[model samples]
Target: MTNGTRTALATALLLAVTAIPTSAVAAPEAAHIEGRLPSGATYLMDVPADWNGTVLLFSHGYRPMGAPNPAQNAPDDTTKALLLDRGYALIGSSYASSGWAVTDAVPDQLATLSVFKDRFGTARRTIAWGQSYGGLVTTAIAERAARRIDGSLAMCGLVHGGVANWNNTLDPVFAVRTLLAPDTDVPLTGFEDQAEATAAAGTLTAAADAAQKTTTGRARLALAAALHNIPVWNDPSQTRPAATDWEAQQANQFPALRGLIQLPAFSWRQEAETRAGGNMSWNTGVDYARLLGQSSVRKEVTELYKKAGLSLGKDLATLNKAPRISADASAMAWMSRTSAFTGKLTKPQLDIHTTGDALVPVQTESALKRAVTAAGSAPMLRQAYTDNAGHCTFSPAEQLSALHTLEDRLTTGRWTGTDPDSLNSRAAKADPTTPARYVPYRPAPYPRPYDLAHPADGR
Candidate 1:
């Protein structure tokens, strides 16, 4: 199918899948659920009347995990229903903000799992499955809930910190910095300084205010662009429709446009307005730029600069002359020190990635393998790589293989899988017409505990 056709079909399939009711297929017996960590946060888990001992607690990707909000595309209710039909008691936590607050979510997940087990009395064997950010959350839970969780099925998950997976890099601050640094040649210092100045002058706030005041479509476009680092037309004199003006231009374009904007190399250019441009759409291209020029966006740009050690009032000349610091303080803070993945893995784990996943690169699996090895937990690691677009864009065969791997680990307490190198090579040899199969699971020899290996915490 053509790319456009594929996208359209995918969108339709997504809508259809999410619209279907879980109750339609093997309705779950309602069970009382309660939250131990986040007071009063609770939900009803419908354990399938014919559920087997296998209980699958889903950790949704990048959204509110345990919340009672209606399921959307991806790991929604329909997906949960499918697992239910497979004889697994499906449990989900109404985790705060889909459990973005990791510290809070961890305790809540354990508590909810406990509630499910106590209420149902059948959750002897448990498997945690999560996609993307949900994968990270799942790993976190697995690391802590080693005694309770039998195995984990993580798709497009960063076994380590999400930031570390250069493939699955999600932080907008990093994405914007990387993109703008190359184009401007002004050293991030200049952008940071401009942001500080804009913040002090209230330039961004004023622009946001102006966009809010005006009913023009261009204004709304400008506001969003500014807020999200959409590159603006360097020539401010260019005229365009207000953002609000084209709000309904192409009804189905917004979500896809937003998804595109999230990509690492997504550039907002003025020339994109022309019809000859291949990938850029007029509304997305124009609004992206206008939003880039907003004051609020500038402030964020400045914040990243500051985080990177470029102080306010520092000229580009000074920043350019400064040495590239060895220790990225921000990275250290968000990743190494506080990150849950910094520790060793105690249980069997499987990580899945896609070679063509534009958002999160396949290299991330290697990076994670190296990081875990470096941390002295190689024995528990296994990875599977697929040659598909986006995260978890695996064929049905690939998904089945992953499911089988999870079942093996849970049932037999052993993971047999090939390493990443072989998987990558095999994927390269496969034709696009052929469905990718799981490169057999091969567990690495477990390394001695970090403390035992180095005696000084492997510093």
Candidate 2:
């Protein structure tokens, strides 16, 4: 999209009017506000007539560099309408740029809040929230912008931080390239441009697609997915596979495996490299066998290999023998600086995740939990899970219920109705038609967790 068109889309919420159905709480009349920040980011805001003295600052997730940039003030249209109906103000920015945008998103969101306060006065309370990459941005704000926001919500976020997230992400793509297409020449990092990245991704994806047809290929794919922490259940419409059904589980993981290699592995990696000035990911001294052993899916991988009449040991040896990739120190430092999570929260933060999110796997919560505990901020954080497949697929009832629960904590100075049963009950009250799937869950430790504290190649 052209720069002008992108700006227009970002400001469209304030420039346009929509007819809201009277059925949803009489469709509160709202005042639209739009502006451009000094950083050149476009922002949009909506405030209802009966203002609730609360504001939600939204930080959107990664958008590919070539895609259209539209400002998202809420996770979805239904959520936006419900927030407005409840007399809450909503605001967000397009961000300075997209694709792994936490660097720009945090500042842009905070700047939008500054603008809102200057225009309408300080809100009684503000909550920062976002999904995917935006979730990381929200966490950063919760850490650094405590004076500005009262609380925060992160949905299917990469809270483990960019350095950790991308490092683990590299593990799977490396496995795919080394095992599935050893003869093919597709660079994993430091791409010349999006065109080069896209081409490499296409080649890798095609290799994965072809590999899925053979038993040996399926076994290798399972190993790659395990390294990536990709969940076995990807299709929300399909029933989750039985734990011991290795065949069905591998089948479910194949699509996520292919998509992960294409997007974050190649396309997103290129964008991140350009922004960071060089390669920020490495596998220089990684032990493929030990990494697989640490994975929750290791048993599944072992079973799949046995069934395929292949030796897992041989493949691991091959992977170990392959040449390792190294990161530029400056680039690695840049990524960590912009995206690392300090886990020092001065305000309450609630993170929600689907148990089977393939993109930002639920294991990310484990890493974040470790950081928060180490930082002595565990009491300020609560993570809830849904027994569902796919990414950020929470029902409207669930979404609203989470916000209400967080708001209750902010108002009462104590957390209540946060357990699965209570959360489900609250969601039922919000919308009885949609079933609430909140369940007690504890994610296993991430297999290839990496952060500044545990730098790659021992830094």
Candidate 3:
């Protein structure tokens, strides 16, 4: 499929120069193919001539419901070229649909693998890897489809499970409604459509923007952000704010919090509710005070409250007494069945995240570790972090280094050189031009963990 244009062009160029010997003819190049699955999801694949008996099955993150559904083979072209040059086959699918696609992604990925084997022959090893929401899909495959693959890598993933993720997102959003726009009757959940959700998001975001003008509003915003564990560092190019710099910290967190409320908490929640058949998130009986106490930015919130001359106790009391949102049992059940993680890792898994990701907080890593430890599969999972300030902000060199590390573990049945220093060193060797900053980090506890094990934590 790939030889027609290139072969003809090369032949023309060769004839223009001189007659080429028949012995000098080259083999046709590998084909890049695209096709759709029975579920209507499209997939892309690249198989090199120097096949290495290994296939890197990639899973992409969420796309908005209305966006184009194009198949992606890797996170970027550089990574794709690097892997293809090194003889690793690459393939990925655009899930059957988008927006909170956890329900369809996992199965579509396994189906893609089935097609890959049928078309390219059975691979000696298959490593599942993904970013963002796809990271959750990769981890879920590690737990549920263990027999089908060798190992997995998840970057910037929401491994804390869907229920917990939405609850954590809802906490700060609920706070924004209760504390700042108490008089505004915005539907915090059960959004009827995108327009409805967007309208609600606009109302809440305007409330947050106006609140930023006053010390009281800023303090309350900080509290709400803390409730969801939004990072104090938002801009990647700017220097990180000092630990005690309350104003700068709040200033940075304000944008991140606003973005989360508009997208994940409202707009994306609408998609999730639609897919799950009803509202699948809740904050009934949640202790906002306790949730703040568990937040990494608790001290910042307190300092801001003090500077604002706001009675922190009174605000907490008001939030505690606010009417709470409830979840539909059937919707919650659907999400749990499809999106919750059991952490029963039957194969080795490696996960990486950016330190200052606002969309999916680094604290979710702590929750993932807890789940794996509970399942007694801690030995099968290893996590690393990059000291960057955005979601999935990984360099091609860093990504190649991670792929090599997982490959080594799978080949040797032992984990080695997985430490931050070793990882950075390998990344430097992979590409000296790109910077890599793998750091040893322990994320704070997820403020409002609400999975199967921590079901009551939401209460």
Please name the candidate that would achieve the greatest TM-score relative to the true structure: 3
* Prediction 1 global C-alpha lDDT: 0.46
Q: Which 10-residue span in candidate 2 carries the lowest summed lDDT?
A: 449-458
- Candidate 2 residue 74 Cα shift, in angstroms, is 0.6
- Clashes found in each candidate (C-alpha, N, C closer than 3 A): 34, 0, 0
Q: Compose the digit string of candidate 1's lDDT tens values, residues 4-42.
A: 999999999999999999878875564434343344434
Q: Quote the positional error of residue 86 for candidate 3 in Å.
A: 1.4
Candidate 3 wrongly placed segments (more than 4 Å): 1-28, 452-459
The number of the candidate with the highest lDDT is 3
**lDDT value for candidate 2?**
0.87
Candidate number with the higher TM-score (2 or 3): 3
User: Can you give the TM-score per candidate against the true fold?
Assistant: 0.52, 0.91, 0.92
- What tens-digit string does per-residue lDDT give for candidate 2 at 1-459? 999998999788555544445475565466898778888888999999898999999988888987988777899988888788888999999998888777788888989999999988999999998888889889999988899999999999989988778788888888999999999888988899989999999998999999999999999999999997778786797668898999999998888888887788888889899989999988888888998887868899999999999999999999999999889999988987888876778899999999989999999999888788877888999999998999999888898889999999999998898899999999999878776999999988876565444433246
The 10-residue segment of model 1 with minimum total lDDT is: 268-277
Q: What is the Cα-based lDDT of residue 39 in candidate 3? A: 95
**Reference-based lDDT, each prediction:** 0.46, 0.87, 0.88
